[model samples]
Target: MDPVRRTPVVVTSALLTLLLTVLIVNLIQPVDAARAERTTAAGASSTSTVSVRRFPKAHHPSKSASSSSATKNQTKQQKPDPAATSAHPVDWLKPSQQVDYPDPAAHPGLSLEVSLQDQRVYVRDGSELLYTMYASTGMDDSTPRGSFRIQNERGDHFYNPREGMGARYYTSFLNHGVFLFHSVPTDSKGGYIKEEADMLGIRPGSHGCIRLTVPDARWIMQSVPTGTPVLVK
Candidate 1:
């Protein structure tokens, strides 16, 4: 059996460079040929046949001469000069994680409010519910009812509902970070599943902070502002 012949993978620009190189070599052939004729006319002895074949130069093209400078610049820019390539490998990769931005001003001067009604969180400014979504709180650790300010906001998370631990968006209203409201698998979307029932009834709930869907988390990040008051109950 014959072994498979692997093909060389040449980048498009490299291939283009090789083509231009060959073309330049071809264009300059006549000049050397003319020079060789002059040498012969001057009574020069014959050198090696290989040497004779090497310098059969021809007339160079003005068109290629003009375009060479532009080609060189293009090649320089297209080639990732090692330093830049090593600096950021994932710069062109697909975005996986979403950034979180918490704002207290979702409701303005009164501050932001996170209320757990039923089994969901009702984000509001004052009396109006800005956004409504499902959540889960601590089974033994009931969500505290208090008015607090957002200490800080995070963009990265690594939460796992299986271990009662992972990444979570924590608000200053809780003892620790567990009260964070991020995303969790829902039992049902709109099947009359309320907040408090699903929140602490089954699975891994929260410590106290308002629980939110992943989408809801991102929404709140955008809607709310930093340094705003967070009233959780």
Candidate 2:
């Protein structure tokens, strides 16, 4: 009610107002700073999420892509060297030539007919005449006639026991692989005896065995099985 009391009260009121104002400002500033930080963090998170969603992810190959890759790999594997293929050609004609022989009609026997008069041999699978080739039978009608069975065979350069001569592709139709059909006799060193090559099939020349060209001898060794019938006439 007095002037002094009123002044002190007014001062106290003013100070209280100032302090409240300061406290409110401090609280408001912290709240605004926190709001700004939260907004910035929210913006960064949104940008990160958008970037992740926009970018593409790695994927597996589709069916078409896989098929293309497989085709490329197969092409790489199957392409052969042209030079190598040209240099070493596979023999495709031999099998075609062999097809000339008629099927045996389930017969078990294969036969060889040695014609001393013609100086030739006829190959037969059962009743079918498959092939024929020249030969040199024994000198002086010494070839064995009638039927015989192939007992043994050999394919190597071997020396004849009597003359110490070498021969190739020896095949035995009689006398247990000793008396034989073989390539024209060679020297001891496996050199060809040209005189014997000239005499082949023109006249009888062997001691007691049949003689043939090297190819024919090898054919008989490979195609003619053991126990095949042989007939000389």
lDDT of each: 0.51, 0.75
lDDT of 1 by residue, 35-120 (tens): 88988966554455546665554324656766998899999999988976542111111111243332444436545555455454
Which prediction has the highest TM-score against the true structure?
2
Candidate 2 minimal-lDDT segment of 10 residues: 87-96
Best by lDDT: 2
Question: What does candidate 2's lDDT look like per residue over 1-233, in tens digits?
Answer: 67877998889999999999999999999999999999999999999998887665323356668899999999988899676564222121122134444333444666889999877788787777777766778898788788988776667668865686777878888878767878777888888677776666667888778878777777777667788888999
Q: What is the C-alpha RMSD of each candidate to the true structure, in Å?
A: 30.9, 14.6
- Provide the TM-score for each candidate, comma-separated: 0.39, 0.53
Off by over 4 Å in 1: 1-112, 159-164, 167-178, 185-204
